[model samples]
Target: MAKAVWKGTLTFGLVSLPVALYPATESHAVRFHQLQRGTTDRVRQRRVNERTGEEVPFEDVVKGYELAEGEYVVVEPAELEELSPGRSRTIEIGGFADLAEIDPVLFDKTYYLGPADPATAKVYQLLVEALAHSRRAGIAVFAMRGKEYLTAVDSTDGLLELRTMHWADELRDPQQEVPDLPARRRDFNRTELATAEQLIEMLSVAWNPDDYHDTREERVRALVEAKAEGREVALSTGAEPEATELTDLVDVLRRSLAEARAARGTGPKGGRSGTAGGSGTAGTAGRPRTVGAAGTVRAAGRPGTAGRSETVGAAGTAGTAGTAGTAGAKGGPKRERARRAPEPPEAVEDLGSLTKAELYRRAAALGVPHRSTMTRDQLQYALKAAARPRRKLGKAS
Candidate 1:
């Protein structure tokens, strides 16, 4: 189990519950230590006095509020500590609002909130269900490490999540920051707009965050591995982006739509032309030849008397039953083939190397209960346990 970053009492309407907060997010970015040029020695930083050029200890450092150029008012730590909110270690809910009212920009960091003790689990669960049913979030102020935070407490999948928020004044004015935005009264070409919308529809796919990955991080790791193996790292210069012309917008949209349709294996009329057996290319006698992941060709097998499927092996060898049916006399009536369900995730032998995001995905696929609150190790253990077959109980002797 992960240690809680903060332990405090949550209060609302005279009811107080003890809760522990655990950070809900982590960064997977690769990090590197500072090193000296042309040397293997690590570089380090230190604080020093500008006038004396002497290193200063952390204990001697004090907070300073600058009022003007070259002038500052030094403040003591004790004074700031006394002024911090939530001195009693409490997060009192100021009010509740519909979660949709909160803008995405206000949400900063996320943390999981759970009952501090097993005895309070009932109250915690009640609160979670209540928030979920009401579709509202408790807006509260929290103090941790002498810093006050505006937080939104909401429930998701039977677990409460607390998201720290930026103050209203902290948000920047987009209109002021961005100078080249199109005017609100600007008119757009109706034909070009329709083409763009059509292109978007053609390219749309289901949203699955697991399908995306950090390519830059993967490249960095590959670079490190290649350097360790004393291998040359191949580099490529990508083609420069072509400048788009507004006059050619419709042509560009049409080209993009065509490319998307081709990538998705759809014809010009947005229809697929594959056999009912599988999505493979056209085969002889109107029987589709399926290609397996291992480069094996599978000739669609007709249902045998024993109701068994004759599959092709990884060496591109076809089964006797499959070939006989597929190579039958021409002009034979088309037989209906059974459609298979989507393939399940492949069994993973080693789960320790996977990141938390990947483990979460696997847990979700395995239908593990209460996975939102589980740590990475807990998720791995749950997945392994779920994969185990249950032993049948023997009759008592």
Candidate 2:
């Protein structure tokens, strides 16, 4: 059973419901022991009093804050209680705002609130049903552990969910940090714009929470478990590779978008393969067949100074092309057919590495529109701009 961390009243006008708050989530981070590398003995923390120059009982110690050099203000339990944010015994909800309007960075810890008494279950159910019908949540202030919390209270399945938020002062001003966009921007051509639109149409689907996974963390845990079991864990190189020549963006967009849209339904085992393709010629052709190559480039585009750079072009031939001997027709091995020889590796510029078609296809994946005529630099800039994660405000003190 989940344990309640707090018991409080939900108050808005005369409507009052006693609720117990329980943490809604738990961290799955790996724990580590501090140990001497040579001895392997775990290190333990000790408590010592400064003035007495002796170890002190854990129960005797009190929380203190330093105000001046070598000066401190020690507070007793009673004094601490007196200074705590005691005004909020009740979760007093004020109003509601569109969930999408929230910056997302403001959201912190989440707590689940349920009726404190079985008799008040009806009240809890009422709130949940009401919120579902109204499509609104309650904004409230609450307190726990002597700290005040600004939170959003929403009801779902007979329980109230409380998500704490950071203060306004905590959000960083991005305009002050990032540089202004270049003056001479490329304009989108009809084909580029049309393909970009088609890609969006292909990939568009209603949000579904189930369509996600933390593959990185899962892979890490799998490796950790393998090591713990004394098994040899080989690093995995994801997927096979092939190469195609860069072609028109229209076909690429169409191919990509189609796959994305097809992923929406309750159909295939894993929509990992389906999606609308971006519109363009040789849409998916002329590009590296493996996602690994493209993934590396995208990951490298972050703020840090470039440690290295990769250029993609025609690479060395990947063995024989369609030299198959006829098998089925004459009850023999199938005959190979003629195909374009794989291009040899050439030092292509970063811009050259991705064709206009490839750029539009990628821009479609990222939900950036008007991509057809977008220059390689524009495409790169847009990708970086769209991939920004929500900024967490005021890291916990």
Candidate 3:
């Protein structure tokens, strides 16, 4: 069991319940130590007194606010703690609001909330049920580690989750920050718009997280292992392609649509009569493929479909099929099993066609897990699952 990061009283209305908060997520990034260049020695840092030129112990250091250049206002830790009497120990809910009304961008870190005392479990469960039923999040504020935080408490999968949020002022106006944004929508030929929309439809598919992985990490691991085993590593340099001109817009759309259709084994007529049960995608072949990466090929198509194969690229490290690329954990390539059936082309015209970022916003609103790392397909899958009603067990009819 993970230790709770915080223990406090959660008060809403006249009811008060002891609750504990635990971090809901963790980082999996590969960490590296700072090392001197061309040497194996590790680099380290220390806090020192500037004027005295001596290292300072943590216990002896006090926070000082610089009023002017050299003028300082020193405050003791005990004094700061005394400023907020019960705030550090209590989470007081101000009110409830529809979850949909809150912008997903404001949500920051997420934590799991549970009863701190075993006897208060019922109250905690009741709160979860109420929030789930009402589809509202409890807005609250609390202090921790000498800092106050704004949070939203909601329920997911019968569990209560608290998410820290950013203040409204923290958000920046895009008009001021972003450059070269189109002032107004440019009028394009209807035929061109239709072609582009059709192209998007041809490339649409269901989200599948299992189909993707961090290819860059895999490459880095492979490089390190290869050098350790005395294997030769080859590097490639490719020129960047020229940008597409505005006059070639329609032509590019038509070509891309045709290529996507052919890859899916569909004809130019846009029918779903391709190989691999019409589920196999071109280039990716259900399993994601990178343009320049591992030198391996795997059998393509979902189970119960015709056997087919596609060659993975062997050039440089680049060009992932989608959000992430699929590769084996070991040195050799691996075949992937297809888990989802192909959706009708009409799905492209639905919510499935939305960008991954847009889907993520929706997923955040629904308290979906792993939303930050989810691929576009995974986000769509999570959204569907969240919206699904749970099955109730009863006597067999």
Candidate 4:
């Protein structure tokens, strides 16, 4: 088990519970040591005095704030300690807010809060249950390591999760830094929009993180291994493909939607051949294809376009049915059957009624991807979408 990083008491209203904070996440990125290019000697950094050109002892190091260009106010360790706030062991909750209201950008680091002693377990569970039932997170200010942090405490997986947050003033507006952003709205063709929506629906599946892989890390490791074995490694110049200019938006969307449906084994096989610009060309079948923002198709697939053999599973079927019911209301008997179809379980309907932690648990159970980083609303939407049924596509006349 990981060791606790902080020990403190959590207090709200008249209740107090002893708790210890444990880091909830860790980084596993590969590390490299600094060494001389030719020699194996490890590179080392040292602290030295600029004036005396002598090494500085760790104990003698003191912090200084620059007053002007050449002047600094030197602060000693003892003086700094005296100026610091008194160490407080209590984390006092100030107020509570709906978890959805908190912006995800503000969250920094997260730590799990565990009961410090067996005696406090009951109180700890009480707080967790209260936060979960109320679907609210408690806001608090905490001081640690001589620095104060704004934090939010919420219940997750039956435990308390405390996340430090950036101050409101720390956030920057992107519009101020970004240049040449579109100022005026551009109208989109209705058919193009409908096609895009269809493509999204066709490609939509339960989030399974295992389906993704970090190829960069694998390539990096391979390069390192090849160099260690004294084997030749060929490197490629990183060049991006030239951008394509789009003429017809609706045609491109239709082709792309057809391709996506085909990839998933729902659309017709064989490519549609036509002029590159006004009438887009649907390249050969069974290839990994992408429809660029400019509506250009980059096709590289096999001979025949085969339907995707993967099943949507039970959760996916539920999500697809729900979605189809909402979209196919105008279709005669099918619409009535869809309307009469059972609604999603009460738990799903009351998603907003549960805490973020409970929502996360539900997402995990439903195989939602990236649940850890998803906002509450995103999770709810994904769950709702996953519970709906996929729409059936008709063959072209």
lDDT of 3 by residue, 1-397 (tens): 7899999999999999999999998765557789999999999898989999899999998889999999999998877877775889999999997655576778899999989999988999999888766767899989888888899998777788899999889987766777864554446566566666555555443334444455456667888889989999986543334466788665554544433544455433322222432222223222322211111122222211122334323221122222111211111111111213223323434667788766765565455544664445555655665243222222233
For residue 228, what is the lDDT in candidate 3?
89
lDDT value for model 2: 0.52
- TM-score of each model, in listed order: 0.66, 0.58, 0.68, 0.68
Tell me the lDDT of candidate 4: 0.58
Identify the superior model by TM-score, candidate 2 or candidate 4. Answer: 4
Could you tell me how far off, in angstroms, the CA of residue 99 lies in candidate 4 after the best superposition?
1.7
Model 1 misplaced regions, further than 4 Å: 68-71, 269-397
For model 4, the stretches where C-alpha displacement exceeds 4 angstroms are 77-88, 184-186, 237-239, 244-248, 269-397
**Residue 318 of candidate 2: its Cα lDDT?**
13
Per-residue C-alpha lDDT of model 2 across residues 98-203, encoded as one tens digit per residue: 4434666678887888889999888888888776555456888776777778888775555578889998887667655557723333464555455555445443
* True-structure lDDT of candidate 1: 0.60
**Number of the candidate with higher TM-score, 2 or 3:** 3
Between candidates 1 and 3, name the one with more favorable TM-score: 3
Q: Report the lDDT of model 3 for residue 129.
A: 80
> What's the ranking of the predictions by TM-score, best on top?
4, 3, 1, 2
Candidate 1 lDDT over 1-397, as tens digits, reads 7799999899888889999999886789989999989999998899999999999999999999999998999998767777864643888898997554466667788899989989988999999988876656899987788788899998787899998999999987766776775445425555555556554554443224343456578889999999999999997654334466777565544544433333344423323322223332222222223333222233333121212222333221233223222222122112101222223333535788887767776666555544565556666766665343222223223
